[model samples]
Target chain A: MDKIEEKELWPEEKSLMKAEISRRKFITSATLAALGLAMTPYATLAAAPSNKPVNFASFVEINTTINGQNMKMKLDPRTSLLDLLREQLGLTGSKKGCNQGACGACTVHMGKDRINSCLTLAAQIDGKEVTTIEGIGSETEFHPIQVAFMEHDGYQCGYCTPGQIMSAIKVLEEDHAGSDAEIREWMSGNICRCGAYKGIVEAVKSVRDETYDKKLIKRTQQKVS
Target chain B: MNPFQYSKAKSADAAINGYMEHDNTAYLAGGTNLVDRIRRDVTHPDYLIDVSELPFSKIEKIEGGLRLGAMASNSDTADDENVKNDYPIVSEAILLGATDQLRNKATNGGNLMQRTRCSYYMSPHFACNKREPGSGCDAIDGHNRILSVLGTSEKCIASYPSDMCTALAALDAVVQIQTPNGGKRSLPLVDFRRLPGDSPEIDTNLKEGELITSIDLPESSKAFAKASHYLKVRDRHSYAFALVSVAAALVMENNMIKDARMALGSVAAKPWRDQEAEAMFIGKKPSRELFEKIAEKTMEGAKGYGENDFKIELGKRAIVKAFMKVAGLS
Candidate 1:
C-alpha cells in the first residue's frame, strides 16, 4: 500500500505523530495474539512519507472484502459497505431501514463477529471475510443458527430477521452473553417494528441453549476420547 | 448517494495523493457512517479515494498501548480477545451500540469520522446548516427531541452519534494518522475530533488527504481495560440511539476510587470527556454521595432546551450506574 505525507504540520500536528508510535507498541502484541502472527509495520501499511513537504487534505481510499468475496473498488470516499453491497454489488440480503445504523437490518459477519453493515464501508474490509444471509449457507442447508431461527419462528415482518440471526450466531461465540437480559442487551442493535421480538428472543435463546449443550457434549466426548 | 467517480488505492500514499489532487473528495473507510450520509443526500462528494487496503487493518500491541489500525473493522475490534480482556470498555461500547452487521462493516476511523445522527440532518426534506451552510436549522422547534444540549450552536445542535467514540473519549485514547507526506502522527482523542462550535460542518482536525491510520490506547491495563463499563439508556429496548450513554473506568483501592475516567455520549456535539468528574472521583469511594456530587459538578454548565431536559437526569443516572458497574459497587 502507498503512504503519503503532509505540509510541515503545526506544532500541534507534530504532537499527534506520537499517537501512532504509542499505539504501534501495544497493538503488535494484541495483533499477534489474535492472528497468531507478527505484523510488520509499513509492511502492511503504506510507506511513511519521506519528509513534510505537502499541504493538508482529507480524502483516502479503503480496500476490503465483502460478503465472503474479495473485492477492490473505488468508493465515494464515503461509500458504506452496506450501500456498496446492496446498491453497487447488489448483495441486498442486508436491509437499510435506518441508514444511520440504529437499525440492524443490514447485519453481516466479519470474520467471527457480526456487525451492522449499514454503518461500514465497502473499502474497509480488505483481506477479511464477510458473511451475509446470502453468504451464510442456504435455505436448504442453513447454518445452525439460521435453522434455529426457523424452528423458533423468528420473524413477522422479517425485515430485521437477517440481522437478528446474524447477531445471534455471533453471540454464540461471546462470553458476555449469559442470561436473557444479557442476550437482549447484546442484541439491541436489531429492531423488529412488527414486534416480533419475542420470536427473535426465543430463536437466540434456543441457539444459546443448544450451544451450552454442545459445550457439555464436547467435554463429555473429550473425556470419552 | 449521488453517482460519483471513484478510485481504489493500493497504498496509503496513493489514497492520500488521490485526496490531495481532488477538491470535493472524501476518504471512505467502513462507510457505515459516510455511505448513509451520502445516501441521505447530506454529503455530496465528487470523488472518493478508497484506502481500505493500505495494510492498516490489524490491531496489535505497541510500546505503550494497543494500536487499532485505521481500517480495523469494528466487528473485529469488538471481538478481539485482547480488546475483550484488556479494553473491555471499548468492546462494551461497541457491543452496546450498533448491531453485529454494522460493526463488521464499520471501521475505527469511520467511527471517529461519523457525524451526528440528527433526525433533521437525515431528512432531505428538512433544512440543516450542517448539510448546507446558512440553510437554517429546522430542529430548533421541529423534531428537537434528540438534539444535543451541549456544544451546539444556534445553527446546528446535532450530537456526534458514536457510542464507541464516547468510550474512546473516556479512555483518553490517541488516533494515528498518516499525512500526505507519509509522515505518521497521533493526536489525543480529545483534540483529534472537533466540536460543532460554529463551523458545524467540520467534525475533525483531519486535513484533506490525510488518512486516519489507527486508534491507540495508553498502556491500557486499566482505564480502557479491566475496570470499565458502558451504560446506555434509551427510549426503546433496542435499535435506538442512546438517549444518554455513559462510559466509565474506575480503579478502586481500599474501597476508594484511586483513579476515574468518565465520558458522556449522545448529549454533546462531540464525546464529552468530563475531566471535572475524574478529578472529583480520585481518592473518593464511589458512594452515592460521591457519584451524585460528580454528576452535579459535570452537569453544572450543561445547557438544554425543550424536550431534552430528561437527558440531564438520564445522564446523571447513567454515570452513576456505569461507575457502580465498573467499581463492582452493585
Candidate 2:
C-alpha cells in the first residue's frame, strides 16, 4: 500500500542506505554499547530513503481478484499475468509452453472472457478478476469439462490440458461448440503437441451434448411441473 | 521485457499527454501485440501508458454507418447484432483471425496497430529493418514463406498480418485520431497504413502521441451489404495466419455488377487494394470470365520472393473465390 516516490538515488546515498540497514541490524544487539537508541524492524526499514528510485522503473502495486479471492501484490511492471500466476502465486496449473500468444497453454479468464495470460501484463489487469485452472476444479471435485476430458482421454502428454479445458468451457459457454468441427475451430488457439485432437474433440463434444440435454430436460421438467 | 513506468489514463487527453511526456512510450490496448513483442525483446519502451480504460469502447450506429470505438474488443464487435447483420464481412473477418480467446482480448485499434508477423522481424537474432532502421533485412533471403509479395521494398518484405484491416479496407472505414495538440483528424483506412517504402520502421502514418479514438464504417447500399464475403486461405483451417485472404464486396443488379470493392491480405506490406482491378468489375455481368480477369488484374504488380512465390497463385485463386462467393455465382 506504500507508494514510494521514484527518483534516481545518488551513488553515495545508495551505498550509505545499504550500510545503514546493516548498521541498524548490528546496533539492535549492541544497544547499550553506543548511542543508546533502540529501533524496531519497521522503524529501521522506514528510515531508508522513501524516495529511493531506480534508473527508469519501479515496483507497481497490482490489486486484483483471482478465482474469487481478493489479492494485492507489488510486482515489477514487466511481469506478465502468467508469470504472476505460476511464479508468484504458485499456480502452476497454467503451463508456460511458449510464453508467447502463439501457444495457448497459459490461458485464463480475465473476468467473463478467456485470454492468453502470457500476453496480459500483470499491472494492466489491476482491479480485474482472473480465473485460472485451479479455480475451475480441484482433485476432490472436478468440473464437468475436466470430467469429460478424463472420460474421453482428452490428452496424452497432458501439457496443454489445462488450457484446453479452460478454452473448452468457454467454447460451450459461448455456444460455439455446436459440433466437433466447430469445437476444433474455436479451440484452435490451444495446441496439443501430442496431437490428441481426436480425444479433445470427443471430450468437448460429449460435454456440449450433455449440457444441451440437461437444459432441454430442465425445460421439459418446468413444463410438466 | 525491459522495465517501464506504467500508468493508466482516465481520458484520451490524459493518454495523449502521458505519451507525449515520454520519448519511448507506447499506448497499451489489449496488449496482445505489444506485450508479445516486449517479451520477445523486439520492442522496448521506457513507458507504457495504459489507455485500455479510456472512454473509447462503444459500438454505436451513427448517422451514416457504424462508429466503432478504438477499445471495443474484437469479440464484442464481431458478435454485435448490428455488425453481424449490417457488416457481415467485418464479423467474418474478425472471426477468421486468432482464436476465440484472443478475439476476446484483442481490441479494434490494437488489431489495426498489429505489427508484421515476419519471423525475421520478430526475432532479435535476425536483422530486420523494421525492428532496427539500419540493421538490414534477413527476411529478404531467409525463410519468408509468409512475407509480402506486394508493396514490398528492398529494405523490408514483412507482410501486414491483419484480416480485420483487409475487411476494413473493403468497407471503406475511416480512422478517427486524437492528435497530441488536442486536435482530431480522420484518414481513410487505406491511407492509415503506409507501404514499406524506404522507411520500413514506420508502420503507420500516425505521429507520436496521436491516439486512435474510433473507426467509422461508412454506410453501404443494401446490395453491397448483402453480397460481401471474407475468404481467408491459410495453412490450417483455424488459427493460423492467412496464406492469402480476400475481402470482396459487390453490388449487383439483375446479374450485372453495379459496384465492387476488393482488398487482399497476407500478400502485401499493407492491405493490398487495387482500384483498377475493382473498377473492372463495375458494369460487368457476373461470370467466371470476368472474375478471372479481375483476379489477374489484382495480381498485376505482385512480385514474390522465391519461397513465397506460391502466394501469387494462391492470392489469385482467393480473389476469384471471394468474388464468386460475394457475387453468389458459386
Candidate 3:
C-alpha cells in the first residue's frame, strides 16, 4: 500500500483520477466492512496484487501515459496492459475477450501501432504512450470512425466494436483502407463473432474515403459547438 | 500468468550479463510468443530481461547483401524499401503469415525462435515430448492435420511454424550471433534450426546465453531477385498458420534454368531445403512434367501420419505451382 501511494500522477489527470480512486477505495472498504471480512491483500483498493505472495517482492515500476493521462505505477509483473487498464485504472473500454493474442478484443494503440493489450505486460509499457477506446472522441464529438460505424451499422453485439475501431483507425492511417478487401485483410485480427464483417468493412472504407454521412457529423459537431 | 522479475538492459553486453547472471531468464523481444507461452504455462521463467530496446534494430547495406537487425519488427522489416526490392519473398512471407497488428509487434528474431502450433504441444492435458522431454507423444496417433509430414521422428513431430525462415532458407541467409564471451559467429540460416531427431527439446543450434544479433542476406542471392514467390496453403485466407508453404526462386537464361532455390515450411521440424532436388532444375527447360518430377524428388522419403498424409500430395502440388509461377510457365 505504501509503495502504491508513493507513485505519482501527472498534474493534468491527477485530480480526476484521485477523486475516482478515492471513491472506489471508499466503496471497497465499506463493502468489506459491512461483510465483516478481513481485507485480503490482493483485494485492497490501492492496486490489484498478484495471486502469489512471491510476486509482491518483485513489483516492477513503470511510468506510462494511458489515454493521454501520465501515470506512474508499481505493477505486479503478471498484470497485462489490459489488466492494468481495466482492473487498476477502471478503464473497461478495452474488453478482454479471449485474454489471448488470438482475439483482438483487447486491441489498443501503443505508440501509433495497434497491439494486443492482453499479450503486452504492463512492465513493458514503461516510457510508452497507450491509447484505449475511452481516449477517442466523446459522446458529443464522435470521431469520424465512430460516426462511420454508426452510419454503416458496423456492429451487431457491439462487443468487438472498440477493438474494430482501434484497428480501423490504424488501417486508415497506414493506407490499408483503400479497398474493402484490403480493409478486411488488415482488420482480420479483430474477430466479430456476430459475423458483422461486411458492415465493419463498409464503415472503415467510408471513414477512409470520407464518405460517412456528412449530416450526422455536422450534428455531432454542432453539439460540440 | 506467472509473476516474474523484469529489467531493461541498456546495452548488448548488459543484456548478456543479465542472462548469464539469472537462472531461467528469457530475453523479451516483442513478447508476442514468449508472453503467450507464459500465460499458457508451457514455459516459465523466473526473470525476463527486456532486450527490445537493443541497438541491433537497424537494417544496413553490408559488403555482400543486406544486414537485417534481429530486433527489427516484422512490419518494418517487410516494409523496408531494400527488402521489398531485393527480397520480395521475405516481405510476402512475413506479410501473409500474421495480421497487421501482429506484424507490428513480432520481431524477426522472435519469429525464428517461435515454437510450433501443434495442438498436443500447446495443451497441458495432452502428452507432448517437445514440451516435456520424456512425456510421450500424442500427436503421433492423434489428429495432426496441421503437423509435419517430412521430418518426423519417434520423439517429436512438431512442425516449426515460421514463414520468414522459409524464405531465408531459400536465400541461404546467415545468422549472426553474439556469444557470452563477446565473440561473434555466423551460421547458415538452414543450419540454425535443427531436426527433432533424438532430442525434440532443443529447437535451435543456439547455445545457452547466446543472442542473435542480425541476419545477413548474401549478395549472391540477388540471382533470383527477379523471379521469386512464396505460396502458403492454410485453412483460411489470412491470420492462420500454414499447412504447407513453398518458397521458390528461379533464374532463367535463354529459356533454360540457370539457377534455382527452393524451401518448404510447415512440413518439417525446420525449413525444408533440398539442394539436390534444386540442382535438377538447373539447365532444364520449364515444363509441367519436369516440375512434377522435381517436386516428387523433393518430397522423397516423406512419411506422414494418418491425418496429415494428404500433406505429402499437397506439398508436391504447392511446390509445382510455386515453381510454375516462379518460372512463368503457368
Candidate 4:
C-alpha cells in the first residue's frame, strides 16, 4: 500500500530524487534546499530558484470507499484512480486498455454515475464511492447484466467484457436501451475490437426488455395495512 | 506523465491564488482532456490546482435562460430538464460527442477549455505551433484530414474540438470568468475562443491566473430553442470527432424564418459562425434553394489542405442538413 512514504522516502525514490537533482545541475546549496523540501513530508518538489515557490502537495491523502470497502491512503498526486484500484487496492477488474479516456476499457462506477477510472485521479475521489467490476456481483451468483452477456454471447476476446458490462448497466439504468440502435449509440464509448457488436447489442436489449417487464410483473397489489 | 504537485482549492479566490502563486500551473477540473494530454506528454504542468470542488457545479435557471456552472459535469448539464427542454441543441451536441463515462466526468468549463485533437498537436513527435511557439506546423503539409479549413494561418491549422461550444455559439452564450485580482468579467462564448493567428499557443482570451466561474445562456436564444438541430458527420456514428458539424436554429413564424442562428464546427480555428451570412436567413422562407445558397455563403472562403478538401463540401451539406431539420423540411 505504501508506494512512497511522506516524510521518510523509500530508498529507491530517494535515489531517484538524488539522481534527478544531480542531473539538473543544481548548486550544492540548491541540492540541500531540494533535499530539505523532500524531507518535509508531503512538500511539493522545489523547482529552480527563479520559479515561484509552489505550495501544492506532492502526497495526497484520501478517504474513499472502493468496491464497498473504506480505504484511507496516502497516494502520489500522479496516481490515477485506475492505478490506485488495480495496483494499490489489488482490484484489477477494471482493465486499462487505453490509459487515456478514448478507450472505455477502464470504465467504473463512481457513485451512481459511470466514469473513466483512467482519467480520474486518486485525489479526486477523496470523499466519493467507487465500484469496479468486482464489486458488482457475487462469485456464486452473477449480476443480471453479466448473466445476460453470457447467455447472449456478448463477448469474444472477453478483454472488453468488464467495461462493456459496466457501461451496459448504466445504459439500461438511464433508459437509453429502448432499442438496438439506441444501445449502440449509448454504448459507443466502449469499443470492442473483437467486433462483437451484434452480441453486445442483443445482451443489452434482452436485459432492457426484462427490466421493463419486471416493473409491471414484480408489482404486487398492496394490501391495506 | 511528469511528476507534479497537486492541491484542491476550496474557493474560486483560493484557486486563483494557487494558480497565481505557481510559476507553471494548470487548474484541474474534469481532468478528462487534461489528464489524457498529460499522459500523452503533449502538455506538462509543474503544479495542478484542483478546482473541481470549488462549488461551481450548479446548473441554475437564470432570468431568461440558464446559468451553467463551470464545474457542472457535461452529463448533468446535458440531462438537466431545463437544458433538454429549452436548450435541446446543447443537450444533443453534448450527447453526440464523447461516451457516457466521459460525459459524466468532463465538466462544462473543461469542455470549453479543451485543446485541439489535431494529431500533430497531440503528439510531441510532430511540429505544432500550438504545442511549441517556434516549432513549425506539420499539419499544414501532413495528414490534415481533421484540420481546420477556415480561419487557419500558416502557423497552425488545428480545429477546435468541442460540439458543446459549437452549440453554445449558436445560443450566444456568455462565459463568466473570475480574474486573478479578485475581479469578475464576462465575454460572449463566440469571442471566448481565439483563432489560431500568429500565436496559436493562446487558445482563449482568458488571461493567466484567471478561472472560468460559469456560462450564461441568454434569453434571446430561447426563440431558437425548439427549432434547433445539431448535425454532426463523423467517421463513426458515435464517440468520434466531427469531420464537419453544424448547429442551426430558426425561429420560424407561419412558414417564414423570423430569425436564424448557425454555426459550423471542425472546419475553422474556432466554431465558424458568420452572423452576417446568417442574417440573410432572417426574412426568407424555408426552401431547399434558399438553404443551398446560405450553405454556400457559409463556406465562401473555407480553404482546405490536401486530405481535408472534402470538409468544405461536407460542411456545406451539414449546414444545409441542419437547416432542413430545424426548418422541419425533408
In candidate 4, what are the lDDT values of residues A4-36, reduced to their tens digit? 353443322343344454544334323454465
RMSD of 1: 15.8
As a TM-score, model 2 comes out at: 0.87
DockQ each: 0.17, 0.20, 0.21, 0.23
Root-mean-square deviation (CA) per prediction? 15.8, 14.4, 12.5, 11.7
**Model 4: how far residue A163 lies from native, Å:** 0.6
lDDT of 2: 0.83
Which candidate gets the maximum lDDT versus the true structure? 3
Residue-wise lDDT of candidate 1 within B162-270, one digit each (tens)?
8888888888889888898879887888777677767777878988677888899878444436578888887876556788888888877787778888888889887
In candidate 3, how many Å is residue B44 off?
A: 0.7
Superior by TM-score: candidate 2 or candidate 3: 3
lDDT of 1 at B27: 80
Residue A32 accuracy (lDDT) in model 2: 28
Clashing pairs in 4: none
Model 2: per-residue Cα lDDT over B1-330, one tens digit each: 466778889889989998988889999999999998886677878889988888889999999889988999999999988888888889999999998888998999999899998876776544678999987776776567889999899999999989999999888899999998999999999899999889999999999889999999888633467889999999888898998899999887888888998999989878888998888988899878888988888888888888899999988888888888777779
Expressed as tens digits, the lDDT of each residue in B123-213 for candidate 4 is 6644679999987776776568889999999899999979999999989999999998889999999999999889999999999998999
Answer with 1 or 2, whichever has the higher lDDT.
Answer: 2
Model 4, which residues run further than 4 Å from truth? A1-57, A211-225
Q: Write the per-residue lDDT of candidate 2 for residues A59-155, one digit (tens) a residue.
A: 7887899988998888788889999999999899899987768779999999889999998989988999999998986444567787778777889
**lDDT score, residue A57, model 1?**
39
Models 1 onward score TM values of: 0.75, 0.87, 0.89, 0.87
DockQ, candidate 4, comes to 0.23
Residue-level lDDT tens digits of model 3 in A19-73: 3556565445445644756432222222233465565778888999988889898
